[model samples]
Target: MPFGGEPPQLLKQRLLYQGRRFSFESSRLRLPNEQEGEWECIRHPGGALAVPVTPEGKLILLRQYRFTVQGRLLEFPAGTVEPSEGPEETIKREIEEETGYRAHRWRKLGEYFMAPGYSDEIIYAYLAEDLELLENPPGQDIDEDIETTLMTVEEVDRAIHSGDLADAKSISAFMLARPFLK
Candidate 1:
């Protein structure tokens, strides 16, 4: 209702591209001023992320190479939500697959759009505790190249401040869960 009056009228929506993970669409709309305009957006199924903490109070993170960024980034374990999968289920599977660790306790941190202006990719964040390393955990995804690291809360804070951890979703997830972290 903040955009003046009623929602803008959608005139048309055309799929511009489609990919395994997401799709792009262009839309024709009539604005509140009754003027026509067009816009493009990326449609995604969204994702889930976890801030995993061990009993010893160390945080579990991933140093993963991201082709788009052209560098390895420190991030929480995360994955896109598959059809019929909730955020919790996605995060659980992702943590095990990515870190070889499973969690016995979990709490919801919060959720936010990764980039609301251009994409509809919401990421649900969780705080995972009571972790145990599996003797034979499921292997990581075929496409993933990752290395695991254990860091203290202080280290995470420093990394965030120093720009060592620059992934938006990971940073948002950690900050959301920080108040609940020990």
Candidate 2:
């Protein structure tokens, strides 16, 4: 047939790695069109990002070393949403925990599926304003070494133009928040 028959349907799923906070699952599916007849998939919980803006039109960003990417990257403060937590609440908590800043105003910017071809991770982006600095908590994740900085909108624009700020999440958030800029 031109449509190549119906796509595969999930048949079974089992957890591969179950951490204290998150779990990864392996799934089994049956494909009618494929001669092999069966396939496997990985399931993962998604993450969230907070694009914090200062009153002076600067964006609060984080610089950290990512082991997977094997480099330091500049990005907005972000984290995975804990179970039973809403996106706004997760963003608020993540911004404070990572950047030592609390936002008074929060606006839902947008959402995106990060690599829908392979993973089912959905990222929720938010715009935060009216920031106040606070003391950072100790015993943060050992692998997390983050430094916070504020960049003007013009600076961000320049980075995007020059191919400096190339992170997908950062680029998406900046584009989504462009209408709010002066």
Give Cα-based local distance difference scores for all models. Answer: 0.94, 0.78
lDDT of 2 by residue, 1-182 (tens): 03465877777777777776455666677667643333333344667898898778789888878887898788988887777887777788888888778889988888887776656667899888898877654324666988888898989888888877778888898899888875
Model 1: residues with Cα > 4 Å off, grouped in runs: 1-5
| Local accuracy of candidate 1 as per-residue lDDT tens digits, 85-110 | 89899999999999999999999988
Candidates in order: C-alpha RMSD to true structure = 2.0, 4.4
Model 1: lDDT equals 0.94
Backbone clashes in model 2, listed as residue pairs: none
